[model samples]
Target: MAALQTPKFVYMNGGLTAWEDARLHIGCESVTRGLSIFEGIKGYWQPDGSFALLMLRLHFARLKRSAMLLHIPFEHDFDEFSAAIFELMTALVEPSRDMWIRTTLYVVEGHWGENTRSDLVLTAYHQDKALPEPVSLGISTWRQPGDDSLPARIKASANYQNSRMARIEAREQGLDDMVMLNQAGRVAEASTAALMMVRDGVISTPPASESTLESLTADFCEQLAIDRGYRFERRPIDRTELLIADELAIGGTLNEITPVKAIGRRELATDTGMLATLRSDYFASVRGGKPHPFAELTTLPKVSA
Candidate 1:
């Protein structure tokens, strides 16, 4: 993972605040019980010196849904959320640098099992554009929690404990990342991304029903695949199938579309250029090189005097 470039300012609650001054009480539910939900958004610095946010509405909609699911009482509408993000970017980020932005809604003042007040915090930092690289993966012993338990679909802070454990296991095993399985012992996703495999010229990924988070980046890749006349399917992926797959990749806001070079000791075939093609298309769309529905750009708002 790339280190974040610390910003001079951040948007907290409703206004701009110094990065050092943005704080939460130690006793808050968000701190004690991990009662927070968040969305990761990417911003591209166009060649013309303007910033464009990728899929702004889709991310915010998911953020709203996450708050609703967790009962975080996120009352801010889409417009207000967009305004705050733009304002923060205008104040904190250089216009020529690409950035990664995180918008989090956390329980600010309540104990467990009580209706809580929530606070919004938006943070953005410099992020450089990089293409996905091949990495090794291990099948984790840690299984993803089912919807009946701590669901994997919610982008909540508490849910990441599962990912944290899996990542630790992977590191100890000397692998780049871990592929988590759902309750049914089927492939769920990578620790922080949605996994996709290619076999027989067809692209396949485990469905959201299989306990994977509904990923915007994965969806964008699927659309690009379809437009390029490649067949795409969503189904349960078995462990054995991964070992012999022709190609494998993982996609997310941060991972983008990373190719998996190996699963355990078995190296996947690299001759197939499908992952490369899709990744190129994805970057192009995000940078406004290609026109697509999901890549609709949101420019910075005008600053008021």
Candidate 2:
């Protein structure tokens, strides 16, 4: 894949401004201490010369909750933020290409344990690509901590260190990614996605209590399964289940319903039966290729200047 160039303009601090000129102090806690909250959002180009963000409301709600959990002292009207994002897409991103949009809030002042000022940056760039092929996964020895250790549901920048460690280990093991277990030794989520396993026609995933992040993509897949009259549930998944399951799939803003071809040397089926239908429906919904039930969730309201 070619490198994606950042657009000349981005929404920063409350306005559509020049990207190169945006700055944050090096000594700020958000920069020095990694105290930042963010969201990963995707938009698909439609045939009507427009792009629609997937689950814009849900993403914005999660971003706000993450900021509050981290004590970043952040506040923003959702409508305003949504409008800003829409405006950025209109100005910087082309309507014919898929795009990834990110909104991050950071603390710009004070030391640890002190209240600080906050700043925001929203960016959009082209990300036209297909979902990845089935990947091989390795079970990481590193354990995902419980919510008491850190806010499990929030998408905080510091929390990704756990995933980063597992990712590095997976690379060393010659695998595509790693799945970390919870403190209870049960399967948690993959690095940045939620995991779902199929066994005897039943699809189940570990609950959020198992330290899985609240994943919008996972929710979408679960809804798709229900709407399609498939059996799906959220429950605890044992570590051994991964090796024995008939099929496994993962979902997130980046992965978007990718299947697992093998787990450490145990090869599994892919693009067959339920997993195949889920994958097909997922891409169709995100890319405007089918009648998507969640299309309204992606539509941004018209913003007047």
Candidate 3:
């Protein structure tokens, strides 16, 4: 296939190479019809010139599921995948710089209509910028697609169109970001991240049953919070109750646990709010290795290379 007129990229078609120079047929199903899946992974740096991955294993596990659904066999070795990510992240994340990583899987080639092919790609990008602070949000005038409707479970390239439409509408309306609702009109998630609401000293997020992607960072935050003795609950959330909640956070790989101050017309109480310490602790864990989780949950190993 003729290459895209873009800058150089590190692409792995079973082996890593400069993607712009890699060879693939135009009939590659993944390229021709978006027959691929991908994941976004993030890592951050510490004062010691080292870096840490946020929810690494969780992201890979999700990637495997995405591959299975697309029938794109993920043939790479696990340890190799981990090492590649480490090497790639270390190369991409400047020492003491915050970063984000993106991994992709695609089909090399097949019949125009056939769905099964085995080709893979990985790309990681980041800047020294800090994670976006939770800013004021606009309740989306748009809604999210149901899980059954679009294989919302798979992080397909196409899913973002839905998210894009909502986000564009929100931005045009002069909003920072918008919270999209499910077909049920129940509060689902923000166009980019998962939604959380605090009530009565508890941090609550809507269940995955309510979202397309069971967000990895959000789940990790909830688990870490619970392990630290904070009560974290997952349940179907009601739309009206969002306004009265003590605090709200949109959780994701990059967004982390930034808190929200308001929704639509109802002004959510921000000052004298209860989630300050929890938020601090979460940032600490993400930006440094001091409070690493007790168990080996991520593909990242105990010893750094």
Candidate 4:
């Protein structure tokens, strides 16, 4: 029989508990109301065999911000959360080829109109041994919800249903992933990332106002474009712009710089595509927590700013 692969430890309310032991009854506020904030963090193995929890400080900051936006107050001490995360990572007797951690904060056991008190769940686990390589995506029938119509900016659990179903529909039709435009018919983003295009040396992205999730990865894309001596514009993007752009990429926690090889019948340029370049740049610095924070937006150095 193949060896068991499930992760064993998870940080629950206050301490580390066995993964199978971490459970909540059905009525938890986070479950019932979908009222939870989370960040997906990746850690890179350093040259010395130690791993740098790349962007540790940044992910926690975003988590805090999402919590605040959801009216679930948190007294976040970034330094402490950093220590906890690393401590949990260190406890692993057998770290995988790489690690991905879903660090989350939510209200415990309650429902509509219930007082929200926070609980934390931090789980670190192994993913498929293969590192992320560029993959294709499709145009999801789903449209991005407007900011007021939905809590579009927060990394709340409630929002993933849209992307989840989008991905499902795409695969059911035999595509990789899906891109979703906003209600305005403006190209908003992919199911879980920010989408951008490259054409005639200019980089273009849908404006955040179109209801794309405010993303750290998107900020990284902008910084990378400036460093690479490319131009950038964020405006309402026409759906056709994506189809005809010279290159296309999507940036997010797990799908950073995923390419759109073909959207329906339109094939993107394979030469020096935006996704290919971003694929190299995004992980190069962020993998081991290198570069200045301004230069490498995904990783740490969230010091005092």
For TM-score, the strongest prediction is 1
Which residue pairs clash within candidate 1?
none
**What TM-score do all the candidates reach, one by one?**
0.94, 0.92, 0.84, 0.88
Per residue, candidate 3 scores C-alpha lDDT tens digits across 52-167 of: 66666667788888877766778766676778777655444444455566787767766653646676566766555464555677777777788777656778876777788888
Of the two candidates 2 and 3, the one with more favorable lDDT, higher being better, is: 2
Query: What tens digits encode model 2's per-residue C-alpha lDDT throughout 242-295?
Result: 999999988888777889999989999897978779889987877667756653
- RMSD (Å) per prediction: 2.3, 2.6, 4.2, 4.3
**lDDT scores of the candidates, listed in order:** 0.85, 0.82, 0.69, 0.73
TM-score winner, 1 or 4: 1
Compose the digit string of candidate 4's lDDT tens values, residues 106-170.
78855564566787778887654364555577888898788886767788888888989998998
Cα lDDT for residue 155, candidate 4: 85
Candidate 3's C-alpha runs over 4 A off are 1-8, 19-26, 112-115, 129-131, 269-272, 294-305
Judged by lDDT against the true structure, how good is candidate 3?
0.69
Which regions in candidate 4 have their CA more than 4 angstroms from the true location? 1-5, 93-96, 110-114, 128-131, 289-292, 295-305
The top-ranked prediction according to lDDT is: 1
Give RMSD (Å) of candidate 4 vs. truth: 4.3
RMSD of candidate 2 to the true fold?
2.6
Ranking by TM-score: 1, 2, 4, 3
